[model samples]
Every structure is written in C-alpha cells, then in structure tokens.
Target: MLDRLAHSRGLPQVIRTDYGKEFCGRAMVVWAHVRGVQLRLIQPGKPSQNVYVESFNSRLRDEYLNEHWFPTLLNARTEIERWRREYNEDRPKKAIGGMTRAAYA
Candidate 1:
C-alpha cells in the first residue's frame, strides 16, 4: 500500500498507523527509516488516536467492500482503485467544508 502510494503520489513524509503486524514488520520499519518517513504509531486499543483513518476505513468497508465480491486479486485491485478514486475525487466530505477531497487537497 505504501509502495503504491509512493509510486502514484510520492512518498508521504509521515505514516500513521496502529501497531498492527503489517505496520510493525521489520521490512516496513526498515523501509520507512530508509525513506526518512516518520511512523506515528497509535497505542494499542486506542482507535481514537487515529480517528480520521478509522472513520475512513469504516466508510470504505460499508460502502465498497460490503457491496463488492471480487473473485481475484486483480479484480479486487481494480475495484478498490475505482472506489478510492470516487472517494477522493467525487465524494464531498463534510469535514472539508463540503469540498471533495481532491479539491480540499
């Protein structure tokens, strides 16, 4: 996921995530350190620390994942990309003064 983001939009200066295995792996730690990306890890069991991401993940799961049944990895990636584009470009977010995320950015 970070690789894809870096490829498309350049690497983020900081990465914020819970201390999940995927985020805490040695490979990811090394990758971030090498790229000078700071990792902000939330305390275990504290979803409030990363409320924005938690909220976004909730909406993505409810609106997209629950509605799709991808039969393959490629199909899943394609569908997820479509949903991501819509979420970032088409949908207006209340938190951003009713602007689409792309516009807000």
Candidate 2:
C-alpha cells in the first residue's frame, strides 16, 4: 500500500503512525530505513496525535464495515476501496470549505 502511494503521489519524507505492531515491526523499520523515510510514532495512549487516521478508522467501521458483509476478501477490498475513493475524492468536507479533497488538492 505504501509502495502504491509512493508511486502515485511520490514519497513522503516522514510517516506518522501509531504504535501498532504492524507499524513497529522490523519489516516496517527496515522499509523506512531503506527509503530514508522517518517514522514518527505517536506517543502511546495519545490517539489525538493521529486524529485524522483515528477519525477515518471510526468512519470506515461505522459507515462501511459494520454495514456490509463480504463472502470474499476481494469483495471486501473492492468495497473498501470504493468507499475510500468516495471519501477522499468525491465527498465534500466542511474543513476544506465544502470542497471535495480531490478538488481542493
């Protein structure tokens, strides 16, 4: 996923993530090291430090995951991707003056 993001939008100098096992693991460490990307792990118990991701996760669970059941992993992925595109590209956000993120960008 990071690779795809880098390919599409270019690499970020720093990645801010929570102290999840997936982000803290050796592979993630090595991947960051190889790319010269700094990994900024938020302090434990401080979800406020990563409010955007936390909010997104909450919306994903409530609006999509909780409402749908998928018989296959591919179906789940497809639906989630659809939701993500709509959220990021189509949905208007009041924070951005009621413009979609894609339009704002």
Candidate 3:
C-alpha cells in the first residue's frame, strides 16, 4: 500500500505510524532506509499520536466494512479498491473546505 502510494503520488518525506508488525519489520525498515524516508513510530499505547489514521480507519469500518460482505479475498480486494477510489475521488472532506479528496490533493 505504501509502495503504491509512493508510485502514484510520490514519496512522502516522513511516515508516521504505530508500531505494527508490518511497519516495524526488517523489510520495511530496509525499504524506508533505501528510499531515504523517515519513519516515526508513535509511542506504544499512544493512540492520540495517530489520531488522524485512527479516525479514518473508524470511518472506513463504519462506512465500508460493516456494510459489505465479501465472499472471497479477491472480491474483497476489488470492492475495497473501488471504495478507496471513491473515497479519494468523490467523498467531500471537511478539512479541505468540503472539496473532494482528489480535488484537495
């Protein structure tokens, strides 16, 4: 997911994340090092530090996950990708003066 974002939108200077195994693995550490990106890990048990992502995730679960039933992994991926595109391209965001996320970007 990070790789896809970097490819599509360019690399971010800094990545802030919690200490999830996926983010803390050796492969991710090496990848970040190779890309010259800074990875800032929030202190354990500090959900406030990653509030933005947490909030987005809550919204995703409420609006998408709880509402859909996927029969297979591939179908789930397809549906989630479609939801992602719609969220990024059409959903209006309050932070950006009610513009769609794509327009804000």
The lDDT of each candidate is 0.92, 0.95, 0.92
- C-alpha lDDT (0 to 100) for residue 9 of candidate 2: 97
For candidate 2, which ten residues in a row score worst on lDDT? 1-10
Candidate with top lDDT is 2
Better of 1 and 2 by TM-score: 2
lDDT of 3 at 55: 86
Error of 1 at 105 (Å): 5.5
Flag regions of model 2 displaced more than 4 Å.
none
Record all residue pairs in model 3 with backbone atoms less than 3 Å apart, i.e. clashing.
none
State the local distance difference test value for candidate 3.
0.92
Whichever of 1 and 2 has more lDDT, that candidate is 2
RMSD of 2: 1.4
